[model samples]
Target: MSEMVIETSNLTRRYGKKISVNNLNLHVPKGSIFGFLGPNGAGKTTTIRMLLGLIRPTSGQIRIFNQTLPKHRMQILRRTGSLVESPSYYGHLSGYENLDVIARLLKVPSKRIDEVLGIVRLTSAAKQSVKGYSLGMKQRLGIAAALLGNPDLLILDEPTNGLDPAGIHEIRALIKELPAQYGITVVVSSHLLGEIDQMATHVGIIERGHLLFQDAIEKLREQNSPKLLLQVDKPLEAKRLLQRAGLQVSMDGDILQMPNQGLAATEDVNRRLIQAGISVYRITEQSRSLEDIFLDFVDKEGSL
Candidate 1:
């Protein structure tokens, strides 16, 4: 089993009279890209700020790298790099100079500055003033600064906020390479579900400050309940044949959901439908998506 890089036990945070984060328990394993997903105003930023010790939690505990946060903040931060919301850069200075300043603040070696600039593919534009750089270039500069410490873990909040499709793809590829090539743990938050589905090894989904689910991406995909969607020429005959086979099948217009049964049994039902003068157009395994599952759970809990 991999080590637990981050753990929160009933983590809670509040602002004045409103509770911004409520009982968020997150476990992010070492060497995995954990996708932190939530709707806007869902307290994702609040949770991140707490993790970095930038803000104090009203209740609960947070542990990073096996050390309690806020108390050993300096210790934890030494091995962590983060980019939250927007990238900060000195417009008047060149990209190289911007990173040079951060390197000095972190007291990193002078050679390390060049290494990170190369890592984010910003070396070519390092001499250009940041004021004339594109949005993507500025974002890359922020990433360069984050890698300055060669931290074991990188926390990025909406890293692709203002990038074009090509820029987004470049960032995605870089993020995917971090864990495998450099042995770094990545915690990324994004509103794009499709991108998260493609990039994450594990996922933690939250809604309205409550943690809805946390598990491996593959495990979540496997948890989808099995159903069959079929298109047939003779919908009526197909329905009748399935019912006669002792299968509880229902038809909605032209589509049908095969009854819960073994895979072999389901195949047999399909064969019967075809043989009963029904021309089967298509047969597909139906599964609920992450978004679908998230909404269903939220609605179910809200009704209680």
Candidate 2:
């Protein structure tokens, strides 16, 4: 197992009688882009706040950088940087000036501000007032500010919310580069499955304050294995022939469906079917989509 930069055990939080976060365990491996995914009001923000020490967990333990939170809050924070929702910035301040304010607070050298500006590709707009900047530019500036501290971990909550396609692409590209270019571990939260699918190496899914899945993105994909699909003549005959020949096959209208055997096996099956006078029009593989898998988890867990 890789080193867990952020590990939680039975972490839970409540607001009055409503439980915002049920018992949860999250493992974020170092140097991995961890996608924190959940629906709105699913306790994603609450979990982030607890991880950042912005709010205390009702019960459970949080360990970041191998140090327990709150006890080492300042120390953990010093090596951690975060941007939750829209970044807080002075509109009147120039991009550089805004970063400088945060830099001063972190006691980071002035040159580090320039470095982060370059990292976020905001150096060209360094002197521009943030009020005049585009939404994407402001997001980049927020990321620059986060990078100013040169922290090992960066957590973002809905960082791409309310952005145009180009803007979203820009942020996604920048985030995808952080791990390899700067050795930064990122914990980015999003409700969009496609966004997480495109960027994250690992994923944690939550719904109604309950975490449904946590593992490498590939593992989630493995849950929905592809099935062989075929459109052929006399589907009933094809199904009967394949099944008798030791291949499990079913019919969906005029098409035949079965588990996707390997290329050679499929080829052998195809040859046998052709010999049996069943014309094969089209052969393809179909699998349940991630959205399908996600919905399955939500539905099944909700009922439980």
The numbered model that scores best in TM-score is 2
How many pairs of residues collide in each model?
0, 0
Candidates' lDDT values, in order? 0.87, 0.93
Per-residue lDDT over 1-304 for candidate 2, one digit per residue giving the tens place of the 0 to 100 score = 6999999999999889999999999999999999999888888999999999999999999999999988999999999999988898999999999999999988899999989999999988999999999999999999998888999999999999999999999999999999999999999999888899899999999998999999999999999877999988878888888889889888778878899868998898889889999899988989899878888888887899
Candidate 1 lDDT over residue span 61-137, tens digit each: 99999999888999999999999999898999999999989999999998998898888888899899999998888
Whole-model lDDT, model 1: 0.87
Model 2 misplacement above 4 A: none
lDDT of predicted model 2 = 0.93
User: For every model shown, what is its TM-score relative to the native structure?
Assistant: 0.91, 0.96
Q: Given candidate 1, what's the lDDT at residue 208?
A: 74
